[model samples]
Target: MTGKIRVVVAKPGLDGHDRGAKVIARALRDAGMEVIYTGLHQTAEQIVETAIQEDADVVGLSVLSGAHMTLVPKVARLLREQGVEDVLVLAGGTIPEEDHEELKREGVLAVFTPGATTTDIVAFIKSSVAGAAA
Candidate 1:
C-alpha cells in the first residue's frame, strides 16, 4: 500500500449534474489524496476501468438520478469481477437513508448524505485505509 490514498470519484449514468461530484473531488484532492474525477455520464464499465487502471484505493460514486440502486452496485460488482477487493467503495448525493444498508451489502463501505462534511469523509478514508492495513 502507498502512503497516499488514490480515489476515483465518478459521476455515473445520465445524472446531468456534477457540482457535488466536482466539489467532493476537489476536497479529496485538497486533502492530499490523488483524485481522478471521471467527469459526467460515465458508465459502470468506464468507472470500474478507471478504478482498476488507477489502482484506486477508494471509489466515490455521486448519484442524484435515482439510479443509485443499479449504478452504484454495478460498479462494486464490476470491481469484484475484475478481482478488485481492497478498494473501499463509498457513495454520496441524494441517497435515501433506507437504501444505505443494501448498498453496503452490495460492497459500498459507506454512504454520505447531503450534509456530510468533507472532514468526515477525509477522516473516514484515512481510518478505513489505515484499519485495513492493520
Candidate 2:
C-alpha cells in the first residue's frame, strides 16, 4: 500500500481486438494505478511474465474471442507456478455469466461482463488488493 497499485491488462491468444483492453488500462492509470497494457496477440506466458516483471497487484485479461477458459486460467496458473499466488486475477469482455464461477475457481477473483462500468472495475481492484501495492 505504500506505492501505487500496478495492473497488467493483457489481450491473450489471437484476439485482435484491443480497444477494451486499452480502455481498462487507461482507466486504471487514471485511477492512479500503474498499468502495463500488453498489446494484442499475447500468449499466456508473455502475460504472466509481464505481470511478474511489473510486480502487478492485479492481472486483467480481456478476451472477446471465446478463449477465456483457455487463456485466463493459464496465465493464473503460470503466475502461481512462479510463486505469485497473490495477484488478483480478473477477466472481462465477452465472458459469460456461467463462466464466472468456474473462472473464480480457477484462480480468477472476478469476471466483468459487457455492461460492467469502469468505475466498478477500478473499485474492485482497489478493494480486492487493499494493502497489496508496494
Candidate 3:
C-alpha cells in the first residue's frame, strides 16, 4: 500500500541452513516487494535492529533448528522492546501445528511449515500487511 512492502527475511540462531531463506527472499522480491535478507546466523537483536533500520513492514524468520520456540518469541519480544510494534513478525520452517498457537501468542503473525509454497507466503504477507493497515 505504501510503496512496495518492505520485508526483512532472517535466519536466526544456530541454523546453518539458508537455502530456504534465500529462495523466499528472491520470491518476495520477484513478487514486487523490497526484501532485505540478513543472511544466516543472526541473533534476535541483529534481526530486530535490521528491521528497525530498514523500517521493515514485515519480518520473516526461517528456522529449521527446532529452536523456533525459543527464537520466535525472542525476536518478537525484541522488536516490541525496540518499539517497532507495527512490524509484522512471521516464521517459516520445521514448526509443528501444536506450536502455532504459542507462536501467535508471542506475537508472530503466522507460521508456515515445510511444504508451504512461495505463492502462499507472498500472498499471506501482502494480505496480512494490507489487512493490518485497514
Candidate 4:
C-alpha cells in the first residue's frame, strides 16, 4: 500500500450506544491507519459521503441498534451506487449469525461481532485493504 489504510468508522441509524465504535476507531488509529469517525446518529448517505470524501480504503460500520439488517445494506448499496469500488465495507456490533451471510451478499466484506479483538480488526483491515490496494 502507498500509505496507511484509510478507514471510515461510522455509527448508522438511531444506535445510541457508541462504546464499541469508539474502541474500534481508536484501535485502527493506533494501528497507524487514518480513521475518520462520523460520530453518532449518521445516516447511510452521510457515511457514504464521508467515505468518498475521505477516499477511504475501508469503511468500518458499527451498529448496535438492531438495524443492521436495514442500515448496513443501505450503506453498502449506496457505496456501489456511487461507484465506490475499492472501499472494503465491514460491520460490527451485536450482529446475529443468521444475518452475517446476507450482509456479505449485500456487499459487506465482513462482520465482526461481540468479543472480536481489536488486534484482529487491525489485522483484517491491513490485509483486506492491501489486497484492494492492488
User: All candidates' lDDT scores?
Assistant: 0.93, 0.90, 0.94, 0.93
List the candidate numbers ranked by TM-score, top first: 4, 3, 1, 2
Candidate 4, pairs of clashing residues: none
Q: Which candidate ranks first by lDDT, i.e. highest?
A: 3
lDDT of 2 by residue, 1-134 (tens): 66898889999999887888888899999999999988999999999999989988899999999999999989989998999988999999998888888899999888998888899999989988895444
Flag the better candidate by TM-score, 2 or 3. 3
Using all chains and alpha carbons, the TM-scores for the candidates as numbered come to 0.96, 0.95, 0.97, 0.98
The lDDT, on a scale of 0 to 1, for candidate 1 is 0.93
Report residue 93 deviation for candidate 4 (angstroms): 0.5
lDDT of 4 by residue, 22-59 (tens): 99999999999899999999999999999999999999
Off by over 4 Å in 1: none
Evaluated at residue 66, the lDDT of candidate 2 is 95
Task: Tell me the tens digit of each residue's lDDT in model 3 across 1-134.
Answer: 77999999999999998988999999999999999999989999999999999999999999999999999999999988887899999999999899999999999999998899999999999999999888
Q: In candidate 3, residue 15 scores what lDDT? A: 94
Better of 1 and 2 by TM-score: 1
- In angstroms, how far off is 101's CA in candidate 4? 0.5
Q: Report the alpha-carbon TM-score of model 2 versus the true structure.
A: 0.95
Angstrom error of the Cα, residue 128, model 2: value is 0.7
